[model samples]
Target: MFQYVFGIPFTLLKFLLLWFWGTLKRLIPYALRWKKSIANEIVLITGGGSGIGRQTALYFARAGATLVLWDVNPDGNAETARLVRDCGMKAYTYTCDVTKREEVYRVAQRVKEEVGTVFILVNNAGIVSGKQFLHLTDEEIIKTMDVNTMAHFWTLRAFLPDMVRSNQGHVVTISSLLGESAVGGLSDYCTSKFAVRGLHDAILREMSVLDSQVKCTVVCPFGVSTGMFDGVKLRHEFLLPFMAPEYVGRKIVQAVLTDTEVLYLPPYVQLLVIAKTILPTSAQLVLEDIIKLNEATKTFTGRRQDTPKKEN
Candidate 1:
């Protein structure tokens, strides 16, 4: 009993010291602009046909990584591959709907046989209905969940085993700020993002238990100009400006190279997450009203039907 009691203070002190050391380690790399090279890495990106996915593929191509793009739209996927080829890097495209589990497995096997094992996997494909709870059709809700949430599970299951065995890989999850703090007019979308965020955290924990070197990053950014949230608007643009797709893509590549665990674009979004956790329910509602978070998506038109879906 005496040893346990006396050890408490020592334990707390050790914890604080370790926390400081970890913070210092993170800062040193940022200060030095240090990033690991991904040259010759095999990168597989879902929804790589458009928006952030396409932009990220371009960035990786510039870094000498071979890209394998999977998307439901053949035209957009082909265009992305063409762009990568223009960069003088190898690029392969496959038309596969991520929402289908069997299709994902089949395509994943083909990628293994044809392109080689993926060293980095970006689960960037997503869709948003931008509909209110009652207004959302059952099909729309299911589709949102399938594309944004279940698709992660399918891809991870198909690829993570090889990564674990090799002890080398990176997994990137493109979530949303709405996943951290919910608002109105996008119940289905918010639900999907939140689910993915949770899944990402769980994967991190499991990876730690397995003592794996495979890194995981989950990104939560505000509305980006990716066409997925085309008409969405924020009341205070100065407080939280809409991010450009290129900027987001660049940041995501940086995070993966640096092995950043969790990234919040604009950075201040992390403060909002803290506020959501600490504030009272009424206070939170008032803050949301001021920011017009609930009304921001009222004007959301999303992607046009004729165009390929914007996968971020």
Candidate 2:
């Protein structure tokens, strides 16, 4: 009756309901004390130099975990290591371009030699060019796929066997909400994220089949406030809030410790997934338009190209 009286489509009402449900989710309390599970775990995080990876490392450091950080940037990796050590935890950094299988293998050997054995693996390294499909160069597209999709496979292959043998480990894959809902400008980025989602799901299925104690968590978050995509415009804050890297990091750490299988962050990003089930094709298009998501890349230039404009 409200929908009819307000002349709003049923789909909008459903979207609103889901949004409200997501907003209220935090009010529903947890059943158990989960924080105690994390102490003294050996955690290896890829892309641990910055953004969510860097933030998660700090969380684990504070929680008393031995840290192994891998990233292409030696400077960034070193900074993260310094910060973790400042937290009074054991931390190590290595320059590893996760896109290459051999690099991951080499790093795995070192991590095993130094840290003993990795008890948790966080595949969080990702790159985004933010170009439209037409403007995306071949190199850019390949780089996106290599870092976002193939890296997950290589990192997991390098670490999973040890996890399986030990029968206690956690694999956390940080995929984006864009994986489920693909937008226009970010074709390559979205494709890679979507593929990683499938990879994570397959891993979960394998774990379930073997009845393994190795837990897996696939994180699907919306736009993150990290300067990775510095120039990209965000249309809405609350409905699709820019997730803080720290918030995502804390969530991932909690999931790894507590044995959660999949974690959709901010708790509300899952509502976008549910939207696909209930919204009509045309209505979905309208919703996307309202969000201004597909065209978000129009203003994006990334960190390298984002030169500040000077007043005349």
Candidate 3:
């Protein structure tokens, strides 16, 4: 067909021009990211009891967004709501077990009734088992997958319908660097996160092709100082350091405000992603050893809370 034969050059030209304009906008001072005001936007954050989710909830609240906090821990989730209210923003807390599909759906309904349709849905709830294959129980593995991977599907299904009708919403998936690079003791965790990364990419691409205004963001940050991964350590702390939860939270919220998609935190970590693509198997193994990647999680003692380090 002539359509296929003739469309290549135009497509290439459009891609190049778009790339150039994006670069130029970054270089220019006044011309920059299109900032979206979060004032009064209903933001529902899973795992908002503590860690990164709590911090992100606060970040959005400070920017004038109303908060809906979901967590299995009643005390901590209430505390986060109190903090948001202290910031003079409306906040409602719902104790939820994100690993359960029915619970997530039911809680989502209560949120809609008690708060309103969520303008921003941040899927920050996740759990890490920190156990090698076979060492982990069947339940632990399933729980990890449920919380880390399947919860995204349930939460998105519950909230995305309204977003489609309005065509104005943001979905943030707090993934992990482990999703990009496999590691021992984190097989389940990595698999789950990788699935989420793919999920976000698919959703974003679909939205783009449909000319939908719904924005999507996927974050892949190294371990944070949150208690969720209290004992993970690398040979060179400076080379591959764990980030602060506050910093991670702030960055994720900034990405949403700017509609920035696919974040690799601290910037330099992106080089590792590139290396993963180009480096051979042996070289990649050697690099992994140099960083003590596999050994790092051996000592990991994640926080004991039900939703510890929710996407930290």
Q: Could you list the CA RMSD of all candidates, in the order they appear? A: 2.6, 9.4, 2.7
Compared with the true structure, the alpha-carbon lDDT of candidate 1 equals 0.89
**lDDT tens string, model 1, 188-216?**
98999999999999998999999999999
Candidate 2 TM-score, true structure as reference: 0.86
lDDT of 2 by residue, 1-312 (tens): 445526877878888987886556445454453444667788999888888889999988988898999887788889999999999998988888888899889889988887788888888888887788888899988988988899888889888999999898889888888888888888998899899999999999998899998888888887777776667775773576677888888887777666566678778668878998899978888988886877778888666554211000
Q: Candidate 3: where are CA atoms >4 Å away?
A: 1-9, 22-32, 304-312
Q: After aligning candidate 2 to the native by TM-score, how far in Å is the CA of 256 from where it should be?
A: 1.8
Reference-based lDDT, each prediction: 0.89, 0.81, 0.86
**Could you give the candidate ranking by lDDT, starting with the highest?**
1, 3, 2
How close is every model to the real structure, measured as TM-score?
0.93, 0.86, 0.92
Shift in Å, residue 278, candidate 3:
0.5
Error of 3 at 223 (Å): 1.0
